[model samples]
Target: MTTALSPVDPDSYRALMAAHPGGVAVVTTDDGLGTPYGFACTAWCGVSLDPPLLLVCASTTGSTLPVLAGRGWFAVNLLHGAGRRAADAFAHRDAGRFSAVPWRPSPATGLPLLPEDAHTAAECRVHRLDPVGDHTVIIGEIVRTTTTRGADQPPLLYGMRRYATWPVP
Candidate 1:
């Protein structure tokens, strides 16, 4: 049984989520065709380690969701501080996402990994996809991982509707 509310207040929900900081990442993949697809995602985390699993949340209605589902593979590119530009570019609904950004396909999963803007990249195979509300939870089993940051640049953090870096103390 499910309770149906009369009206859903999205503003308050948005405000609540916005109050918490989240690390940014770009999820990229390609269709069996030559076309590539990607998007900026903030809802991500690792769920297990023995089998090496992680999860990323994306809108079920996003154009790239089908590509990810069909291919059963994707790359999670952890964006560094310098990747805000790339994040914004991918956030928009358009083609040519990789036109200006430098990227390469992951060796393990053949998913697109942005080396130019990402601090690290993880190639994963889809373990399962669970649809929750308006979003799909992509549970992945990490097959390959690499870091290009050289332990210097920290990943971008999004909070209060802005991009930032972790504070140095």
Candidate 2:
């Protein structure tokens, strides 16, 4: 069960959110005719284990959202420290997001994917889109996954206004 609450203090909410470490990821999609689009995201969440669902939140005003709308397919690249440049480049509104990065298609899913060196990547077929507050929740069914480091590599993490990681000891 859940309870209702008053409007949050924006500053306090921001601070609280910053305290929580989030794994960095980049969501990408293409028009399938050469035009590609994507953005850096940290709001990825797994929704279900039975149906293999994943969720990602994106702003309505973002550049990639338009291209992704109703496309029914996308790829999520989990970033490591080496992917910081990729994350920054995709965060912009330029039309050259894919061109700036080296990428290829997933063999199993035929979805456009990043090069083999990312920590991991997943190809997803979108299941639904839900609007919540200032963002849209993108729900996708994970069709295939490819990984180089699996759980062994330390992922790029963001917390308290910076990037971070804690290697397994």
Candidate 3:
């Protein structure tokens, strides 16, 4: 069954999404100029298993969005508990996003993959694209993956007003 809510304001939608905690990740790819581009995204998700698919959303106006959408390959570097700063750095429209962060190449996709706080890395190839509101949902097929030293490290969570760590129970 499908359900719908009464039409709400955009702020309400933002507020609602803000209330739901999400794991952080940096999606990166080279822009064909030997220069890498990336952005922090909380909208990344696993989409399928048989084809090894994943999805990441990018704002229509984001500078790096075009590069990522045009590139055939990209990498999703899952952020660990200490990656809050890295997230903030990449989230902005700045040229120094990579200068402050450390990364290496993904053997499968040849994309830049974060080497630190990258609890998990997924090298992917673009599979499909869907326009959703003000963002584009880019679906990819995972080609390679790695689990870093922080397999047990709590993921950096974004919700409401700030970053948080999952409590150990």
Candidate 4:
């Protein structure tokens, strides 16, 4: 039977999502100038395999969103367990996020890459952008990827308002 449903409260929705763990990454890009921008993200996932598409969500009001749209390129730096500081720094809305973490440019896209913090990084060209509610979902076609760490390294994770790491075997 079909039943009427009420709109979910934002707080409740957030709390519910907090229970679902997700791997963390730092999404970085530049404004085509020397300046850079980035943010910690857990709302990203691989969307396709045939064409190598990755999806990342960003807040519409964030400072980096405009630059990303303008440049049409970005890099996803998948953080490892030792990347706690980088994750924390980018998660906040501040002007010093880059200063708090060491980074270099991705060779293919000229986007920022967290060389010290991320185990794997992918440079992507924007494929499409979909604005959903308060966030925009960016679909990108990965052009190049670099792996800096070995498989033994655990990935950083977040859930329940806390940071965690994958258990190494």
Candidate 5:
């Protein structure tokens, strides 16, 4: 049996998804052109644990999207509460995304990784690629992972049109 469905506008679907809160991440990789490209992404999620997999979505029109799709390895840097500016810088259409931040190359993936971010970083190798709608769904196998209770800083949250911080309890 098939279920009938109504077509929803793309903008409406985006708005609906924006209503849900998601953790922000910076997906970075070397373009194999002697330059590192990064972008702020809120579409990152954990896909599995057995083989250690994670997923991040990239828009087809984004400049770094093609580089990421073709690259075999990449890094995911989870931002902390104070990383809103860093996130905005990378998310924009400028070339200074990696200029204002202090990041280093991942030892495993050779991708740029934010050393000061909430201390959460992952180096992954592309495992699967699925074209869905206007974005590509990338599933990566985690080759390396790091996390530290370095600071008690709250996390940066994006919802609606504003940035927020978690309340202290």
Candidate 6:
């Protein structure tokens, strides 16, 4: 029962996960200087309901990681099926990601909110940050949430190294 298995290579692991689809979200934060930072993320999920906890994994080398860790707050903008462009914009690591994306500040925490692309947005206070391998798992306690789009709208998804939309019938 305690047989040790060989570690999987990075490329192999990536290939395995590419078969599993997940919803897309843009994780955003500010540098406390009015400059915003964000990245398109698929590694996120709800953790608990009682305390309203959710987790999003940020790349260790990502630019937004330091800012959000220092600021102690962030926003999660859940993309709709029509938000492929916004997702693509933030997916790249660059300083101009926000130039084309229309956004406003969240009411509660003043974090960047994707008003046009996001179907649902959550403002959170960072509860814990755990560094795991090449990514840091950010656990957030949801402070405020907003639903900007209707339930009939499908969610944007990523899998098989491509972007796809959930089939809503």
Poorest stretch of ten by lDDT in candidate 2: 109-118
On residues 1-169, what C-alpha lDDT tens digit does candidate 2 reach at each position? 8899898899998999899989888898877675677888889989999899999998898877777875678889888766777777777887777777788766675566665426888889889999898889999999888886534667888789888765757
Over 1-169, each residue of candidate 6 has an lDDT whose tens digit, in order, gives 6998999998999999999999999999998877899999999999999899999999999899999999999999999998888899999997899997888887678899997898999899999999999999999999999998533589999999999988877
lDDT of each: 0.87, 0.80, 0.86, 0.92, 0.81, 0.92
Higher-ranked by TM-score: 4 or 6: 4
Candidate 4 stretches greater than 4 Å from native: none
The parts of candidate 5 lying over 4 Å away from their true place are 1-5, 148-151
Model 4 misses residue 13 by how many Å? Answer: 0.4
Candidate 5's displacement at residue 19, Å, is 1.4
Clashing pairs in 6: none
Superposition error at 34 for model 1 (Å): 4.0
lDDT score of model 6?
0.92
Pairs that collide, model 4: none
Kindly give the stretch of ten consecutive residues in candidate 3 with the minimal lDDT sum.
Answer: 101-110
lDDT, residue 48, candidate 1: 99
List model 4 lDDT by residue over 1-169, tens digit each. Answer: 9899998999999999999999999999999986999999999999999899999999999999999999999999999999999999999999999999898876666799888899999899999999999999999999999998533589999999998999877
lDDT tens string, model 1, 1-169?
9988775499988988889989999999889564679999899999998899999999988998889999888889999888888898888887877886888877666678888899898888899999999999999999898899533787799989988987755
> What C-alpha RMSD separates each model from the true structure?
2.6, 3.1, 2.7, 1.2, 2.3, 1.4
lDDT string for model 3 (64-116, tens) is 77887787778899999988778888989899988888877776666887878
Put down candidate 5 lDDT per residue, 36-121, tens digits, no spaces: 88888889899999999999998877877788878888888888788787788887878888887888776656788887764588
TM-score of each: 0.91, 0.86, 0.90, 0.96, 0.88, 0.95
Ranking by TM-score: 4, 6, 1, 3, 5, 2
On TM-score, the candidate that comes out on top is 4
Candidate 5 worst ten-residue window by lDDT: 146-155
CA displacement after TM-score superposition, residue 36 of candidate 6 (Å): 0.3
